[model samples]
Target: MAVTVISLVVAFLYGGPQALFLCVILGILEVSLSFDNAVINATVLRRMSEFWQRIFLTVGILIAVFGMRLVFPLAIVWIASGLGPIAALDLALNPPPDGAAYFPNGDPSYETLITDAHPQIAAFGGMFLLMLFLHFILEDREIKWLEWLERPLAKAGKLEQLEVVVATALLLITATVIAPDDKVSTVMIAGALGMITYIAVNGLGEMFHVPEEGEEPEGGPSGLAKATGKAGFFLFLYLEVLDASFSFDGVIGAFAITSDPIIIALGLGFIGAMFVRSITIFLVRKGTLSDYVYLEHGAHWAIGALALILLYSIGTHVPEVITGLVGVALIGAALGSSIYRNRKIAAREGEDAVKTSIP
Candidate 1:
């Protein structure tokens, strides 16, 4: 809260009331879009040690703010536009004049350059997130939220490397059929890298993870496992990458609100990212997921929707609100279901108590 106040005050001092207002809107937008992210983050974070959680809030946030939101976009522009580092930074700070062509002429703005590179960015983020969703849904779990659908997917999970095979096939189809001819290579490469990253990080975590005595080996991504040592490191890395994937679309969409990178950083990166970190920590500490059983399911479903949205975005434009709303809607339904189930359980317990008391 203090950070938000300071941030808005700084914005006002720097760019007047308009900047302050934009910052607030961007911060709100980021929070709304990433509520599911907080839930998912809590899942992995719960498995992490307190020290690691502190590192996540501090060091990890630095990476999210500057690494992903600020520097990464600048790097994207530099690569796409073939500009010097200093020049790229400058172009980003001072985009094209207000009335000129929006993209790719003699002097394209940073937004244009980065937007042109969207195919690769989307592919990479999309494939990674898709793998996450697939790993969760396809794995056999004792608990099932959408039993009708999850049960079948769990049975299919018995097939070795089924998730990988499915993910690969989707990537290939998106690259060859959905993506433009000129962009096929970039899409394939980026999407492949996304797949490889997920496999490596998740695989490393799973390989090093040691279940406690009598504990059944987890069949899913192993996020439920309280990993330590090398496994913990990989889990931390996985969380960071997951954060980057979730932030990719937001970082880009912020341009639509304000071209100023500083405001984008203040709104989307600092205030917004801080809130998400806080929310994750709160959820972990409170063990809310244990009470609301369907949240994780809802979050993963939202992730699947987001992954497909990102992949589809490579070919065409999607309203940013749609992405956020999809997540909100799925998670909302899950929360409702959880409440209903909890009430039903309580009622049954009450009835049993009455019968026992009468006897």
Candidate 2:
């Protein structure tokens, strides 16, 4: 809260009251869109020791804010435009006077360049998130928010490497059928890397986190599979990748609000990302996941939706508002179910207590 207030004050100084207002809106939107992220973060974070958790909140935020929001975008522009690092930074700092119209012989603005690169960006982030959602769908969990849907999916998971086969097919269709003729290879390559990254990080963590001869495995009922040393490093990398995937949407979406990269870095990275980390820690400390039960299921569902949305955005424009709303709706439904279940259980327990008293 203090950080939020301070940020707003700083924003006010930066561009007066209007900038302050924009910051607030960006913060709220980011938090809403990232509700699923907090849930997913808690799932991974609880497995880490307190030391790593601190690293996540501190060092992780720096990478998320300055690295992804600022430098990542710049890097994208740099590579896409084939410009030197300093030239790319200069281009970002001085976007074209008007985004909608291009001069006959002028270069595309920073916003235009980033917007043009959406297909590749979407390809990479979408596939990574799709793999995440697929893993959750394939896992055999005791709890299910939508059993009618999840049970059949779980049964289908018996097939060997089914997720990989399905993901590859989807990538091929998107690349060949959906992508522009010129961009087909770009989409395929980016999406393939996304898939490989997910597999390598997730597999390494599981492979290395095996318990030593004496000790019980650490992950709780959810089968988180955690460890220190190399395992922790992989887990940390996984978390960073997860953040990058989540931020892809926000980074692109912010252009809809403002094209100024500096303001975006401040709004999304400084205030918005910080709030997300705080929410993750709060969920971990409160044991919210253990209590809510279906919350994690909802988060994964939201992620699946987001992955599809990202893939769709490659061919068409999608409003950022829709993306944020979808996440909030799934999470809200799961929370409602959890509350109802808790009440029913409490009522039954009360009846049992009364019967015992009568005896």
Candidate 3:
């Protein structure tokens, strides 16, 4: 309620009632596009301590809403345009000049600036997300979803830093083949930084992870032991990066609705982000992932799909609706599979109990 009210007020202040409507629409669009992000976030957030969870809800909200939605875009524009922060803000608020090539159809707008930087942004976000998906799929786990593909990847995981190698190869191929000649360097650098950022943050998380004294380190450490103070901090960083990677697509897609940065922030930030955070908390508290065992598998697969879409988007424009639908479909299918598997298990257990009673 507070988020809706605040969003309404912000929209009104930015551009009257019409702006309010657009803001609401953008908010809905963001929520629809990012539902999978909420699921993935819940998976990680469930591992952190209560204190870290609270911080994610409170402090993290501030960063997601303001840092990523507002300041991040402005920072991008500033760096790309070589404008001062104030000038960039002004550029964002006002329309573009006549005959400006950056603005599509000669319409000067902040969206133009953001659109112009899409290649680099897409490269960075795509590589980071791709690496994340690879890490999840390649790691040896008890539950295997697509065994035919994942099993081989799990075997390959035996090779040292194989995920990193695969990700680097993909980045190089993308830059060399798909990216335009003029933008090749920019794409390569951005993609490399994305991979580096993932490795650094992931390493930091592992470094801080302290296994419990008596627990066997099967997969490094027990969840409880791994959620220490320092580990939680690094986990927080991981979640933030994950959120940022998801937001790259959302932010770029928001332009399809409207170019006003304020409206985009009000829509995506106040409403969409608040909803995602709430969903994450709800899933954590309810243990949704545990109940639906395959849900995590589905989410990771969705992430893999999304990562590919982000990478392909660098070469061509993919509609936001298509991206959202693909994720939703994967998650929905996973839920169905989980339900089916649960029913089968219950039936088998019932039959066993009946046979024992007869004997």
Which candidate has the highest TM-score of all?
1
Candidate 2 lDDT tens digits, 236-286: 788999999999999898877877677787788788999999999999999
> Considering only N, C-alpha and C atoms within 3 Å, which residue pairs clash in candidate 1?
none
**Given candidate 2, what's the lDDT at residue 68?**
87
lDDT of 1 by residue, 35-147 (tens): 99999999888777777788889999899888887888888877777888898888877776673435446677777777788899899999999999999999998788899
Q: Between the candidate structures 1 and 3, which one is better when assessed by lDDT?
A: 1
Q: How well does each candidate superpose onto the true structure, as a TM-score? A: 0.93, 0.92, 0.92
Model 3, residue 179: what's the lDDT?
81
Minimal lDDT window, size 10, model 3 = 99-108
Candidate 3 all-Cα RMSD: 3.0
Q: Which whole-number lDDT from 0 to 100 does residue 179 have in model 1? A: 91
| Minimal lDDT window, size 10, model 2 | 219-228
Superposed by TM-score, candidate 3 places the C-alpha of residue 331 at a distance from the truth, in angstroms, of 1.0
Clash pairs (backbone) in predicted model 3: 96-108
Q: What TM-score should be assigned to candidate 3?
A: 0.92
Candidate 1, run of 10 with poorest lDDT: 220-229
